[model samples]
Target: MNAPSGASGYDAVVLGGGVAGCVLAARLSEDADRSVCMVEAGPDYGAEPRHWPHKVLNARALPRDDVWERHTAVHRIRARVLGGSSCINGCWNTWGSATDHEEWVRAGGPRWSASAMERHRLRAVEQMGLRAVPERELSLWARAALEAAEELGYGHVAMAAPGRPGFGTPLINAVDGVRWNAAFAYLDAARQRPNLTILSQTTVNRLDVRTGRVRGVELDVDGRRETVVADTYLVACGTFGSPALLLRSGIGPADHLREFGIRTEVDLTGVGANLSDQPGIFVPLAPTPDLNAALAAKEASGNLYVSRMLIRAASDLCPDSSWDLHILPSAGAPLFGSLPPGQYEAGISAFLMKPASRGHVRLRSADHSEPLDIDPAFSTDPDGHDIAVLRSGLEIVERMAVSAALKPLAGAAQGHPSRDLSDEEIRSRLGAYWHPVGTCAMGQDDDPWAVVDEEARVRGVSNLRVVDASILPTVPAANTQLPVLTVAEMLADALRTDGR
Candidate 1:
């Protein structure tokens, strides 16, 4: 309603300066003529890595700082920083199977094919400087896990690209001990460009979508309200944040918006529906004295990463050439809490990579600062397929525990082993892999569940697009960091090709 209060309008105003936002802002501004602005809810430590908080830059552990919610439900955890989850995740990069591309191609188009997306994936890998886990960085626990995978008949294969089910170390975006997040990898150099403007500590209140087009964006910066306009508005606020923003702007299910008395501009029910995320259960193991000592030494040398190697294992229910699980073995400082001086936590976690269950994200209210109602619905499928696949993955955990390579390092199950646990018990222990997607999934126009089209444009809304993990129709059977980066890169290419 009101004229934009501050700076002049931009060619593209990117909401949420997360991983995808960074890539889009950097790539779109490459034309030099197009002005781009990236707005983030949290602080940006500038372009210098040395200025960032050490806890955020440290690759060995997940820092609790710069998070949306703290000491709350683990399932709702997501970073609020400029670099997004990349600043707080495990710093590992792994690619999904070709089967994942088939699913995407079915929903979107051939552009999502493995071959079509390969160049984008490789570009993301190169831009981030991803490298395989060095021998010194692999803790003794990880080395033993590698041996156990080989002993179990899983032939070695790369983790950064698709291949038959196998075990190997993942490529990492970390250098030495520093976590090279998207901000550092993509935005650092872009900061030097005059065409790009990075706005930190700015929260998007809502989009002024009128006549099926975004008019302007209401923002809250340092408690001061203002409006910013752009020719094209790109929402890269991530899975949870993106849908929540749309809902606040009355772009979700009409019935739900009516409850909050917000006028609905679009009646799309898929804006926040079809939420998908990987659910995993950790089978804790009591480490041997030698294991703890080795881990301690690794910590002393700043190389103690909780996990480095993983096995892409096919569940019995999985297809022939695809894997449905990631068997992760880790031993080091606990992800959440600390241990006594030389002691540590050790375990093998079985992650249900390709799950069938779905969840939804809803607006708690119209307030921008209010957290969205997020339900992962982990293992809540009606037919119990997800629970069964997770159970099968746990079986792999049991076998990995008993292998000669791991049995000597980590003695036995410390508490109730996953194999002996009932379905309900296992569900109680379920932890998310921190990969949430499909909030604004892409699909054909005929699909009622589809929110966005193949080009990441929201249905029935012009001058608006969502370029982030939120646009993915399903969570890939891998950690989502690299995939998100690649998706951003591909969408940026699409924008460039169209000259929008």
Candidate 2:
């Protein structure tokens, strides 16, 4: 973390040094004149991969370290490290369906179209070092799952590039077993800049807003209070953190901020609304003896990837030529809890990629350290569209589990979660894929709930912009890592152009 020298303050104070924050700081600092400071709540651990925790570097399993919480609720869990969720996710990267872009183009104009974003997308790919899964990394279960999808009439399709719905491996940001996070990609070289500052383990309390502008940011640095003034304050604190920061600064619904006894600066109703995440249901299966032995051998070689391929299958409710469900199968160490020395857990999971159900994030209090109140509200849409689509996906899971290609290795399904339960039971046992977006959504000024404009600048507040997943009005039907990185890179380009 950097300190306050004789220099007054930074040119741009980028709050929340997550995926987007790292990119913004690196790109903006390229000019050699713009002073940029990146504030992150978690420890930076320096710029070397060897300096990072071993658990964080291992890509075979999602690490519990460097996260916001360590409870049983997976949906509420979020990364708090400099690299953010990229340091803790499954490393699967997918460009969502074409229909998702149509929605983005409508909300954010032609600049968000597929053709427009392609350049930025390719740049992110190169910077992040995303690559296809190699043959050595695929476990026997993954191979069998691929054959199973093929047997079921689905052909192999590239998951990284936008294309028709099919099954194939996703582009991964991992090499060997190390997790290649955004900090390593974007922030390593930027740290050498004399004008760039990386502040870690520093908490942002709130923004000092008066009238229609932000004056400075109130931060809690090493138990001491400080105020950092900047020409512009950009909030890239992610989907949950971004909204909570706005609400604590008195920018959310006037009625909600009043409940916290905070002074209101702007009454933005969409600061923490429209939370979207992919909810999934896992169907357990009894692994065959040979399958267990094969998995054991793979683990011995340190090349065991629980899931290497995924099926993007279109449900009845999905838009034509686009998929709304991600069917994943896995056989490895349990995602939660543990298995015996030689035994492993096997299952097929159905993820509702394009859910219609919307949720929200709210501040429990004005305190910055306290957790925000988050309600994913999965499968709660009034029309039951999410429920219907999820059930349809599970139906596919059941068929895949019993298919000849998979049955020989996984034996038989213990019982499908949806076989005999009501919709309530289905909802109770559901787990999240951990791809969340849309808290501070983007829109035109006329839209009542729009928090930011197409340029990601917050409404009614000059010089305050939000460039993260929170600004996405709709969740794409794919993992959020790639999309968020692409958005940050694109916005950084625009901001650099303006400064020039």
Candidate 3:
């Protein structure tokens, strides 16, 4: 753990160094008049080996240099560093559609209108210096996938070009082709501000609430207890951590918190509710005998492109109803859980989009140091739309395999060569897509269960706010990196206006 060796005081404290947390600190300190403090429980990503762009050459799992590992009946991975998960995730970026924000507004999160979010989205791209890629300039595989879709009569997809939806190459948070995490984009710049102080390796054990208002927080610093006080504090600790913090502070489903002997500070039953994420239905393909030479292409020349293909299938198969299919070209050697060597050395993988089922993040115990229970509630919802989409994705991939463009490279299917794979078979094989969201939601009205309001202020509490993925009312149809960054940018400006 990277501990801060100094005492600090600031007008506000931004907890968690992920995309939202870093942005909160950076944006708040922009005026140079107010002081801000940002703390992360993880190590620094700058000195880590896994963060190297070229390190992709190594097929082995990146070493857990700066991340923290927690054990339970189920194993989970978390980055305990200045950059949070951004330090360890693959550089796949996705921005939400306009409809995404409209839904939020409808869900009671005012000021979250699609147009409002677009303003922030533009600022986020400018902050990161991201240039839009022309669809025609996309790599061969990407072009082929697009072409294949057209041939199969599913042609309305877009590329990574600006202002397009459905299928476009992702806009990575990579600077100069290297991963550009939140700490790099916002926090690192904020660290240079004289009024901003960053305390690393410090974990907040609980919030110190007094008289139904937030006073400060309690911390477990290197196994020692410490109390922190500030005029205002923000919990950017993420969906899982944010709710867990509330539970430890005696806020949550009343009965659940009481069982642990922690008196309820606020009975917010929705604290850990509305959890969700996207899962995939993978389709493996091998290069044709002629393209074996292409399989040996240099690492520098190979890149993976992720785009979605909306599939219309039986609604009965999927109840929650929203779904999309992901397409990625096989770059080189086999990935985790590879099959026999002769398998198509290069191919495409697909995933179900906009899953309908929801999951929950809950406390296994009230102990701050204990790991929180995570059900991710995957596929438990019978009303979910992903089950149908997964089956549809299987059929679509099979259709592409037979297309003139993909057929030459993918060849005739083997084993079950009849393009007749079952939905159950697809479900059995595909895995989660890694876009988890919406544990700590923000809304208006009398919903005490909502942790925060439209302006990002924590409900029932003053001088505190939450600026992270947890506040997302609905997960976007695409990647979350861009949206998370946008939220940070917007909040930064909002905080400035509020402070004035």
Candidate 4:
């Protein structure tokens, strides 16, 4: 369906039709009295599964070729679609631990505590159709991994269920081979509502602010410049995009904005600081003959090659807290990237779920068309805390590889350049799991770097809020899709209660 002409005067304008944007648009529009508009920079295939691209619908391989790439090796992927990264991500549905939200409460307030966020989590789970791929349907490789973990005494643990933590098959937001992205799960049901308008292929240049109040947004629609007026404006453009939008709107650090010749609206130093991601390293293992044969047979049966098993555990760094490491295995090596033909290989991708290192996203120019400078600063913590956690995770992977259950299926370990390496060598191999957060962190008023408040309202600005991974003061201990959805749900609930 074509977007309505002359888009203007919406009760709430949600920029970036990503996971959070979709949730906010749907929930806010439910009032029937409020008018909502969702704008996406990429193509929106409407609400039909048939309309979606085959690459996007497939829940097996991630569509990384279609994403926007940054210069950094650790933080490179960003999907520009209606569902955002949810449309092109590994379908791992992990809610993390209750402690993750507790940390948020400590940073923000009581409203962000674990108990307060539970309702939203339940709502997201039901709405997204999150469930485990039955053991009957598990790939041979995934089953073997689960068996191996069990042999090592980790036992079967449900990662998707709330507050339950142990080693188990990871649940996914996939049903019957189709990836149930946020757009399909949330926005589809609300698209028909006359109060909601979805504008595809529309890029938001910046928000229009006057005297500390946001009046509307300036957009580049179909090569034509236009202004979209709204009482409230929400930036749900993920971690990088949200901060970039704020910076372009002259609402970031004063020195940075003045350097670009743009007038400063809000001198918020924390607009793009405090970036964090899950630092990870992949250990490739040559598959034994028996495992190789099983993989071939499984592939011939037309089953997905990806593994669903994930092991979450805490390292010695945080023994008292919840799990801080995620050990994920893949059936085939080529599933992630190119490999030698006929070489059957699987890899253990382990990440430090709670990283200590922080990074930042800054504007290269005032132009909206230019990409922002994203530096995740992987393993760069001053106290060497990030590297310590990552090294411990690697040690766990090594143990898993040499375990009795996996001995029959595992062969020699393959490392980058060579198999033998020092601690520093391993640290150099550190990469990211592509989960970036905390760029536009929400904190109390006294905090100098806090960009938003507990209510998600942008600091020093009226009628403008940020609702995405950017507002997360810290990254969650699991895949960010569920947490981002839950946060958006909580924000929507708050907005509803405010009666705005």
- Report how far residue 389 has shifted in candidate 4, in Å: 1.0
Q: What tens-digit string does per-residue lDDT give for candidate 2 at 1-500? A: 65453324878999988899989999999988899888999889789999999999899999987887777488998889999988999988999989989999888999899889999999999999999998999998998899999998998898988888999999999999889999999999889899998888888999998988888898887777788889989999999999999999989899999998998899999989999999999888999999999999999999998888999999888889899999999889998899999899999999999998999999898998888899999999999999898889988998898888899988665554456767998999899999889999999878998999988989999989999999988999899999999999999998887772
lDDT of 4 by residue, 278-346 (tens): 878878787877787777776666565567788887778764647889988777647545756445668
Task: Give me the runs in candidate 1 sitting further than 4 Å from their true place.
Answer: 1-7
Model 3 weakest 10-residue run by lDDT:
306-315
Tell me each candidate's TM-score.
Answer: 0.98, 0.98, 0.85, 0.95
lDDT, candidates in the order shown = 0.91, 0.90, 0.64, 0.82
Cα RMSDs of all predictions? 1.8, 1.3, 4.2, 2.1
Decreasing lDDT order of the candidates = 1, 2, 4, 3
Q: Against the correct fold, how does model 2 do in TM-score?
A: 0.98
Model 4, C-alpha of 413: deviation from truth (Å): 2.8
lDDT of 4: 0.82
Better of 1 and 4 by TM-score: 1
Task: Please give the distance, in angstroms, between residue 57's alpha carbon in candidate 2 and its true position after superposition.
Answer: 0.3
lDDT of 1: 0.91
Error of 4 at 140 (Å): 2.5
* Model 1, TM vs. native: 0.98
lDDT of 1 by residue, 1-500 (tens): 12235746899999988899999998999999998888899888988888999999988889888999889889899889998999989898999998899999999999999999999999999999999888899888888899999999999999999788999988999999999999999988888899888888888999999989999899997788888899999999999999999998989999999988889998898989999999999888999999999999999997888898999999888988999999999898888777899999999999999999999999988898887899999998999899899989989999999999999998776576677788899888899999999999999989998999999999989899999999999899999999999999999999988877
For residues 1-500, what per-residue lDDT tens digits would candidate 3 score against the true structure?
A: 34344444568888888768877877888878888777778654453445544542121123245555544221145567776666666555655545566668866555677666777887877776555444432444445666776676643533222233334455555543355566776665665668877777788888888667877777778888766667788888876788788778876788888778888877887788888776765566656655554433422353322222232222234323232446454434453545455332455556544566777888887777777777665555685456656656666667777787767766643567423655466556656666677777876676655767877776667787778888887787666677788887888888888882
